[model samples]
Target: MSVQPDLFDRSLFRIRRHRALKAAKPGADFLLRAVAVDLEERLLLINRTFGTAVDLGGHTGLVTQAIVNAGKAGRVLRADLQVADPNLPLPDLVCDDALLPLGDQSVDLIVSALTLQFVNDLPGTLIQIRRALAPDGFFLATLPGAGTLTELRDSLTRAELEIRGGAAARVLPFADTRDLGSLLQRAGFALPVTDLDTITVRYDTMFALLNDLRAMGATSILKDRSRTPISRRVLFRAAELYAENHSDPDGRIRATFALVTLSGWAPHESQQKPLRPGSAKASLAEALGAKEQKL
Candidate 1:
């Protein structure tokens, strides 16, 4: 069956609003800083070969600044779903979604950090990335992986069940390492690789962690959510449960950030080719027999 194009869900606006509110917080700033550094490194590597690069989801122009400072790329395009501020220093800022606004084979490299997880049609976005890249170009991205924010999720689940007889909306959704690799391959990227890194952070309270998420523009995008405001009683109970169960002896709540980095190249005709079936000199069973004999 042919896949359908995934539309941007309106429910994500709520999550974005919460994250925008939290962006000024220290923890959120720290996380974005680290992500920006990673993006800068990727851009530098790509710049070694290509003169033009694009930074998708370049919020506030941090990565754009890094690219400009590297002085390798002749032109850097900073694009995002929305332009939160028009006064950012980025020279080529464009406000558009990832799947649109880019032309085929127009860019040398496409770098996106901490952006793909919010996309409902991740495969489509990747395909678009491939289309936007020049021949033999590179695409690099970083996204939250499974196991991120588990502490917050667990605490919220427990509190909601105790108070309202069910769980609250899921705050985040992330792809696993293997699945991300498959996605890159499915999107027609060559030499796809995915690596996972875990970052553990301690917060003074669960509320602090939530605030950071809000600042980072990371939140739930549930479509059928209740419009009623969250009650203070529920919030306090959730905090108490989180502190009691998920806190360390130092009285800090813990949260894990699972970062996944993916890199791939646009396919080229000069690259090595895969062997056809029955092309190998030895069969798998023969190879196993040889190994057994060696033992």
Candidate 2:
């Protein structure tokens, strides 16, 4: 069998996360906090409380804190690339999302925020997550989806092509909602659902958007990334292109983040199941109370 090559550099991702943690400033975790609030609302909708919950790849423990504050979990343990921010809360396990050490059927709930987009083997990781979840357990995760950084991606690609007559993959490709839904089913989850949440953030300049990505530890870590440093000419040109193409009337640039949410439950007898083909008692025409029309 042929082996699949890794698409992302895990070591570089960890190093970048460490740097982001060290240089983090106020509002750097704005996305995480926002997602945490969203997750809390989701958990609130569920009536059952979790016996053991895990904040998988929780960088600053914001999701973990949210789980605690929701009062829906009996115990919450955090995990990440490292203890990115010890000042906030330490992780019970330091591990990559691809490599989970948690035992099979151990956790009742698992919530990951702002992670999984960088995982080299997302399908395998999802399978592992499925294995770790107890029967009828719940899983919720939010990550940057297909159209996360369209403005930056277009600007950078254009600028690089103009300067060097060529361009590499600067922005990592994000997961598609359809593909994620399929993956959830492939991983043996029941009642799988995936949806996109688009958020537009305005920045004074393109550089400001770049800095925000850096602060969020979301910079490129592609395996085939260029080793050469981005020159000033390219950076400035990219900024100019960005302003020209994606700017508000007030001259602020627009950056789009399409956050994708995936939610599912481990298979169990109690959970709802779809009816088998040809098993439905009522036909579509009968349900609609109209005769079926043939084309």
**Candidate topping lDDT:** 2
Q: Which digits, one per residue and each the tens of the lDDT, describe model 1 over residues 1-295?
A: 9866444454466447434843445446677678778767666664366668887876667777776776657788887555443335544654454445778998987777777787767888899889888888888888899999888778777888888887756556578999999999999999898999888889998888877777777766555555566677778888998899888998988889999999998898865678898899886768677543433
lDDT of each: 0.75, 0.90
Give the Cα error of residue 266 in candidate 2, in Å: 0.6
**Tens digits of per-residue lDDT for model 2, 1-295:** 9989999998898888888888877798898889999999999889999899999976777898889988999999888665456556556878878889989999999999988888888899999999999998999999999998999999999999999999878898998889989999999989999988999999999989888889988899999899998999999999999999999999999999999999999899998778899999888999989998888
What stretches of model 2 exceed 4 Å from their correct place?
Answer: 284-295
Ten-residue stretch with the least lDDT total in model 2: 81-90
- Which regions of candidate 1 fall more than 4 Å away from where they truly are? 1-8, 11-27, 42-47, 69-72, 84-87, 280-295
Q: What is the C-alpha RMSD of each candidate to the true structure, in Å?
A: 3.8, 2.0
